[model samples]
Target: MATTFENLLYDLDAATGILTLTVNRPNKLNALNATTIAELGQAIAQARQDGAVRGILLTGSGEKAFVAGADIAELAQLSGPAAQEAAARGQAVFREFETSPKPVVAAVNGFALGGGCELAMACHIRVAAEHARFGQPEVNLGLLPGYGGTQRLVQLVGKGKALELLLTADQVKADEALRLGLANHVVP
Candidate 1:
């Protein structure tokens, strides 16, 4: 059975013991708006307490992106403390995934930029599709990755590569992501 949400599809597989959480905002390239993030936190919390769920598989709804990024429209309105609070909330929710006792794996089917990339890094493992692209393009927006992207990208890909990616705001293709150790596997 699947739990209903406005922004997510939360389904638990009894046979596999894996809870699959799909971000369902393809029109926005599955962007993480505040509502979606809150729903994700709620679903993850339920999965954590559910004995039936042994692990989690996170992904997006469409072929274009696992999650494109944070909702830029929502972002455009914030400044100072408001922006800080939003980032802090996002960070806390992502932290839950990072500290989950049950394994959380990201199925990176497409673009995982900004907060999307951070979400993938929070997972215990990331499996990318052949066309998946990863980056921290926050620099272009005059913002830094606010969801542990700096630390996790460095941990996954090494300081030199991480710095280059962060500074340049360039996207890494699937094969390159695998080479950089940002992705565990790339499937065709």
Candidate 2:
């Protein structure tokens, strides 16, 4: 059976007990907005409580991106308290995947930038498609990644490389991601 939300698609593989959660916002390249973040939290909570769900496979809807980044439109409107709250909410949701007892795997099919990269890093394992690209590009906007990207990028790829990427806003391809230990596997 499949459960559909405004911005997500939750499908269960009964035989394997795997829940596939797709970020369904191809028009926005699966950007993480506040509503999407809240929905993800709700879904993760449900998966945690459901015995039928043994693991999770997270991915985006389109071939262009797993998640391109946060919703830039919404981000442009943030102010004092709202910005902090949004960052906190995003961090908390990503932390849920990080601490999940059941494995949470990211299937990175394409661009995983900024918050997208942070989300992928939070997963227990990351599987990237051959054309996948990962990076923390918030520096280009005169800002830093606000959703645990800095810390997780450092943890996955080491401080030197993480700093380089964060500083330059350069992207790494799937093979490089695997070599750097950011991705467990790369597929065709």
Candidate 3:
């Protein structure tokens, strides 16, 4: 049976022992808002504690996005300290994938920008659909990636490419993402 915690849906595969986490915000392109992030963190913690969950597959609900980015509306209202706190919360939540004893894989079906890209980077592996797109367009908003994007992007792609992307805020398509080492695989 699948369980939903606010904006996240958690389903454990009986045969494969793989838990799938779906970010359930298609209307907003599964954007990472504060509530959604909190729900996602809770679901991940639950999966980690569940003995039946051997691994995790993370994705978004709609075909249009696997999390387009952070919720811009919520971000616009934040005070300086509040914004910092929000970024810290998102970073800690994304860190769960790295610290998880069970492997966490990202199924990058569509857009993965800003916090979305950082979230994918936290995973042990990433598989992208042919139409998937990745970027850290925080620069366009006068903000740098606040969710470990700089560090993880550098670790995945080389420092040169990471810096270029960070500075340009240019989106990378699936094939280029695979070639650049941002994604492990790209399927057509």
lDDT of 2 at 188: 98
RMSD (Cα, Å) for all candidates, in order, is 0.7, 0.8, 0.8
Choose the strongest candidate by lDDT.
1
lDDT of 1 by residue, 8-73 (tens): 999899999999999999999999999999998998899889999999999999999999999999
lDDT of each: 0.95, 0.94, 0.93
Q: Model 3 — which ten-residue stretch has the worst lDDT?
A: 1-10
Candidate 3 collision pairs: none
After TM-score superposition, what is the CA distance of residue 124 in candidate 1 from its true location, in Å?
0.4
TM-score of 2: 0.98
Q: For residues 1-188, what per-residue lDDT tens digits would candidate 2 score against the true structure? A: 67768999999999999999999999999999998999899899889998999999999999999999999999999996899999999999999999999999999999999899999999999999999999988999998999898998889889999999999999999999999999999999
Q: How close to the true structure is residue 40 of candidate 2, measured as C-alpha lDDT?
A: 92
lDDT for model 1 = 0.95
Report model 3's TM-score to 2 decimal places: 0.98
Alpha-carbon runs more than 4 Å astray in model 3: none
Decide which is better by TM-score, 1 or 3.
1
Could you tell me the lDDT of residue 98 within candidate 1?
A: 94
